[model samples]
Target: MRNKPPSLTESQYFLLAALLDGPLHGYGIIKATEQATDGRLRLAVGTLYGALDRLERARLVEADHEEIVDGRARRYYRLTNDGAAALQIEARRLQQAANVVIGRTRTAEA
Candidate 1:
């Protein structure tokens, strides 16, 4: 039997989702996540970088490239195929969980 993919944390899920469009630098990721969550998730710089490091090590994400901005190096990260697959699995899981409650609510309302 095939093993199920490990579940992702809320922050990790959002971080990967933020890169769905394309590669994004640190600040871009932060902004994208915030916008995606409608400001509900504001990733602190330290937390962002820490998660990025862990994701990188897991091979779910990689440093796509780097650029020097104002003498500081900016690294951009991109999601790997594995990461995309994991995200999809997590999304479906979340939908199914939500559906359970939604189904109950509808039944009660009827």
Candidate 2:
């Protein structure tokens, strides 16, 4: 089997990370991602949907179908096993990146 594609942006990272907990609909995912990033990331509707489409195509996230909420259809998403594994890899990559920065910052301060 081929390896999963790497995350291309912070938004992609946020998307995968948000789904770490469980499945979420479009709006729920968006809100969770924004909050997780401390409001540093706010996805427009188009952007959010676009990312979802790409991720679903990649087999990372799958559409769980529509749920009626307040008399409206909301598309939900659930991470696949591959998606969870990918998220783990990305998290490790991010933690390593942070470690490098922290180490350098400490050395600079010292």
Candidate 3:
């Protein structure tokens, strides 16, 4: 049996983070993810599209509209209210986790 996917993967987190700033097309999302991760992550077209499809299904992300860019049709994506709220919660969770790690490291040094 195939393992069920997590509610949110790191890629999804990055993609949602990108939408936090504004809506973006596929290529734009790829670029934004790269920039956000400081080039640590590069999303392939297939991977990016797959993530978008799943997010749309979850009602977390919606296609705003198609825009013409360089003679190509680009579908822009925006975060829905649910998506924004989810991201906020995930961010807070991560922040709390980071604080714990920091506290551990500081104690180790002391």
Candidate 4:
């Protein structure tokens, strides 16, 4: 059976994070993710597109429009309301978990 789908994958988190500022084309999303992660998460073209497809189907993202970039067609995407909500929830969860670790480390040092 297929697993539950509420949980966001790392790729999804990064993608959604990139869109939090505004819409972006595939390459823009790739660059944003790389820059945000300080070059730690370079996504291959196929992987980025595949993740975009999944996010689109999940209603977490939507294609804004298509445009030509140096004779190649590029599609822009933006996060939906659901996507923003999911991203916010995931970020809060991560922040809370991080606080626990930080508190433990500080206590041990004290």
Which candidate leads the pack in TM-score? Answer: 1
Q: Please, what are the lDDT tens digits per residue for candidate 2 over residues 1-103? A: 1586657578877888888888888888889989998999998989999998998888889987787889988888988888888788888888999999999
Q: Order the candidates by lDDT, highest first.
A: 1, 4, 3, 2
Model 2 gets an lDDT of: 0.85
Give lDDT: candidate 3, residue 6.
39
**Candidate order by TM-score, highest to lowest?**
1, 4, 3, 2
Q: Could you give candidate 3's per-residue lDDT for residues 69-90 as a string of tens digits?
A: 7898988999988888778778
Kindly state the number of residue pairs that clash in model 3: 0
lDDT of 1 by residue, 1-110 (tens): 03466679999999999999999999999999999999999999999999999888777899999999999999999999888888999999999999999999999999
Question: In candidate 3, what residue range of length 10 has the lowest lDDT sum?
Answer: 1-10
lDDT of 1 at 51: 94
Q: List the residue pairs that clash in candidate 4.
A: none
Query: Which candidate, 2 or 4, has the higher lDDT?
Result: 4
Q: What are the lDDT figures for the candidates, one per model?
A: 0.93, 0.85, 0.86, 0.90
Q: Whose lDDT is higher: candidate 1's or candidate 4's?
A: 1
Task: Give residue 96's error in model 3 in angstroms.
Answer: 1.3
Give the alpha carbon lDDT tens digit for every residue of 34-101 in model 4. 99999999989999999999988888899999999899998999999888888888898889999999
User: RMSD to native for every prediction?
Assistant: 1.8, 1.6, 4.4, 3.3
